[model samples]
Target chain A: MPVSTLTDPTLKDAHYLVDTGFEHGEMLTIVGKCEVDYDGRASSHLAPGERLVILKPDGTLLVHRNKQRKPVNWQPPGSTHSARLDDNRLIVESVRSSPHEELEITFQTVVQVSRLEVDDVSDLELEGSEEDLRQRILADPDILETGFNAMATERETSAGPIDIYGQDADGTPIAVELKRRRVGPDAVSQLNRYVEALERNRPSKSVRGILVAPSVTERAKQLLTSEGLEFVSLTPEQEDISQPIGFSEDADK
Target chain B: MPVSTLTDPTLKDAHYLVDTGFEHGEMLTIVGKCEVDYDGRASSHLAPGERLVILKPDGTLLVHRNKQRKPVNWQPPGSTHSARLDDNRLIVESVRSSPHEELEITFQTVVQVSRLEVDDVSDLELEGSEEDLRQRILADPDILETGFNAMATERETSAGPIDIYGQDADGTPIAVELKRRRVGPDAVSQLNRYVEALERNRPSKSVRGILVAPSVTERAKQLLTSEGLEFVSLTPEQEDISQPIGFSEDADK
Candidate 1:
């Protein structure tokens, strides 16, 4: 069966099904009124409420309330999960080590429980990331600045990897940092570190740092100015200006 | 009915149930073989695969595969959702404005669809936060420093809100920044901004800046030293040493 569901089952039945689901590596969903306690990097306690709890095969546990996108409490993947009937209540616990977090859910009433067989193996292809921004600049170096000669990307330095490393028309070394969205002083600091590393590698040479992003915060701008860095306004998405406004040769087709 | 489920429903039936689910403001879960497309701050496309799709009444959508804690793709709360039948496929669309993101799922085969009635209205009470750390310091100021007297918390500064504002034994004003976890240079920069702001506000008086966290990164330590700031090793959680090791009063009870 692709899915096995029980509505308003006895605690013993629910525990049996949950244990079977765990052993068979199935995704289980339990809707019930439960109080949750979490102890880890942080500790939290949720009062008794009816919520949806998902236990994934890979040891991901999510306790979601009705109102928000984020789980009220969650144990990340690689946690060990167990379910048992304690007294008359069904207790579910998920535990993970190395930082050590534990999530415990005690159910007052189980409204529904389901075990699902899921098979998924597809990768998401994404665009308009920092990588895409780098690609755009590499494809048209003039877009960054006229006479900007591209040299290397993800060039490693003592500090970290430079997003785009190159030289200008004057042959002065330049280190470029790319951000897909509006950034703050941290990005500026990152670029500064890379520039400092480059200068240290070649003490006689001066390296110019440029930050490429859609926009920058006021503090970031101030820091850039203090550090003698440059900012270029650009987005990761390719500009729509490539389409001609008027007549097209393929209009008849 | 608390939950209405359909297994291997026809495309038309799935569309009808989905439309009904939307109209009734119920949580809907759809498991199917589908391809997904997303466009917004970023864009993505997922090839056909079996996955679980969740739609919350508050207008949140989540696309989950079998693995990973995070949803493969999600539209946060407040995105409008709609389902329609196109040719022989069922297409569900979620869209939100102000940054304008859209997620589209085209299901080639609907395995199961469930509409659940959920009622949850409980807030999570959390501990081991920066606020908890602040409380711990306020309760026993000496943990921060000898003769340290806490004055205010969330004190307003031009840069932002200072976590804790206090005075040292010398009566010199101190601005303490709190972090629940280990931090990097960004935390140092934030503390620096607050200290600078405080100095500007009272030019003649010397102000001290201190960062309190479990630990600091190497670069952050260097930056703190350069700025002449101080770091104290502390965690948000109350120490377990409160219990006497050999003789516990609770042992008799």
Candidate 2:
């Protein structure tokens, strides 16, 4: 294209393929375009052509970007939190990539301000009342909260007993008791101890006990079934135990 | 243990397990102590009976923290950065869990007050003089200044060419035209075009051509090798070249 053609009004709103002249990542500046969404980087799908246009706050535009846009060379590394101007929060859903490994995130600041945020696809679909939220937390396949502290025969001291607890959708309580390999007479005894301790304290009627493991010992399952306690097995399918949760509170500020 | 025996004089400057009467991960106030260096967290490893001590910047002690460490029971959602002391700067080495994978860090204002700066780890271990530094950049494994730009060819409107144009260690000119994949007859022809275009405009013997890719066609490699041009073959080790050779200065900043 001619130099004059590059300055044409038609291409003003379009994204110009600016070469950052760096190595390893792709960096592009939309002449007059603001990103409406984030498709993985490096795909030309950010929108076709080069153009510039002023956008009103209330105006909406349809942008078709190549899915393969990547970072241009010399660009710093970072993650996108959100793609929309109005949307300020980015939620990254917990994904299990390896067996027997828990995912963790570390940052220097507990909070951040960013033009980008990641939305967890699974977390977006949660909907329901308090009862539904509670049920969802119990059956959530992604996380399992167990109550081990409740099974202590007695308070060994004020040090406190170990307790495994997961919250329900409406902030209810769900306690789970887990077995390492198999459940047997010992598990039954342990469960009895926990039930008795919990009964003494009577934390909440909504607080239910669940026994989870890869394979429940026949005796443990039988005990739980006989006791009428609910139980679930671990699986990869993300079960909605609650609503989409995040703590980006710019509105309040 | 009796409160009278708590003030033992034998324990000084040695690590001791403070009976933090609370759970792990919870913040505790330093209440009482004899003399020791406790970073505020209490470990469970006390030798039957040991006292906890905390040091302070001023001559006076802060407080003794014991029986107050609470275990981290809840992870706040969307909190990305960790807590830093008043005198420390936040440096993000890498992002742990993210939607779009990239490293992130920020330098806070606190470090500026403390006169702390980012460490140059890459340059520390190497024993290099001024000349060596320049020569090292020219050599492989040390990425000095490299960039990419669109160059025009006679047959093509424009082709993406990687440029390794910079000053050598000795302040001499340094420039190279590199092809990411295979070098074809057109590539050789293309390099000649770039060289001529660059030489005609900017005369420098430091400008050269480099063809980089996996194994090239035998004939193509022969031709490029014979012309005294550089060939960066894709060895098994080089197959995974996603990492940059040198750390960017801004990466840790």
Candidate 3:
């Protein structure tokens, strides 16, 4: 693997694209001061200042401040990364197709740039949680097999947070409420409020509500039917894989 | 720089320490299921499951689950890392000295291991908000420079969370309440609650209250003095470094 470490004075704008290969698992780390504005799920602003920007081979982009271990802002893996120079500033954008997340960072000045040809991968370790399961459903659209195209996840309504906002195959608006456990009547009531709020705010027509959980009780199903809502049960592949295999003292033999 | 990608079928325990050099700018990523127990700062447990683990050259150890982009647990840089085989598991440990944080991960199985020799870094970019500023004070006691040793951050009491809990050089128990903006009387009231709660809970003697903020007004300072509390003002290093440089239309020309 080859490594190139260059100072800002020696770096050309084309180096972000032509000089390094990022898709082949190459890594790029840039240290600079930047003005960052994120307009995706939410809008945030970072005044121009000294910041560390990392572009990884796996398509993870992180914007870090000197004080915290965690990046102040970042786009998770599977986001598409593009680096381009605009006028006097270098612009890097990371876009995610599923959740429609986009992070744009504009570097006012470049202090340094280093690119590494990364080849060491039997496979990079990737982990996921229930949120990932929701993302998978959004990305595939067919995971539900219910012909639902998830429009959004964790979209906020006046009433509360709608776990999944989408439309049926016929383009009817659908709101989904997610739960890691077996949902009950309280969950139904919460979903009812969210659906009511959505419909009240967008009152051109009625909106549909859907309760999503690993399992839904019969009582909850009755409530859902009474409320004119739907249900979707998801069993993540890792759910079964993550269950611990029981061991006993006798098993040591 | 040499890169090594190996599978456990051909990996020996000694190779974790021998086959690759991690002290130099190298990154080691291990993927497998592990039972993890973290007993520093706070105690957390992770049942056996597939997980991603990363060990950086700077001694930052991260244990990741499949749910979120962030690691489930991690230790900051400047920690010591050691990997070895214990019983039927692979044990990885990272130990940090200041404020003392330790993370231990036991890998139940090994799916893949990759070591990368990295050569790229000019400077690190750092950013942090008020929360980050408070965390930095908690993590490094020496930052106070007031002979105050921060014991724990955000320690919960009946009233609320104490920003910093520690002892002064004279061995007096101190409870700190942090605010990023100018201190006000409401902050004093909150700090008074936290201090009173701490003293009530551990009541052999009284625990003194301290107000920490970026800047304190004269009225707030008078209130603190009247309440028998101390005040510490901080202007984070990152704060000055992060201020945006002015660029006018003339400059654009």
TM-score of chain B of 2: 0.28
Worst 10 residues of 1 chain A by lDDT: A243-252
TM-score ranking of the models:
1, 3, 2
lDDT of 1 by residue, A1-253 (tens): 2888788899889998999999999999898899999999899999999888999999999988877889999999999999988889999999999879999999999888888888888889999999999999999999999999989998998666899999999999999999999998778878987898799889998999999999999978987987799999999999888666667868857
Per-model lDDT: 0.91, 0.29, 0.67
A71-128, model 3: which lDDT tens digit per residue?
6678888888787777777788889876687788887766556554433222233233
Residue-level error in angstroms, candidate 1, position A68: 1.3
For model 3, what fraction of the real interface contacts is kept?
0.02
Please name the candidate that would achieve the greatest DockQ relative to the true structure. Answer: 1
What is the C-alpha lDDT profile of model 2 across A1-253, one tens digit per residue? Answer: 0010122122212212121101112211122222221221111112212111111111111111111111111111122111211123211111122221111111111111101011111111212222332343345434444332222222221112323454445555445555433345334434444444454465555455565544666655665665556565543233456855565576548
TM-score head-to-head 1 vs 3, winner: 1
Better DockQ candidate (2, 3): 3
How accurate locally is residue B236 in candidate 3, as Cα lDDT from 0 to 100? 39
Query: Number of clashing residue pairs in every model?
Result: 0, 70, 10
Q: Is candidate 1 or 2 superior in lDDT?
A: 1
What is model 1's DockQ versus the real complex? 0.64
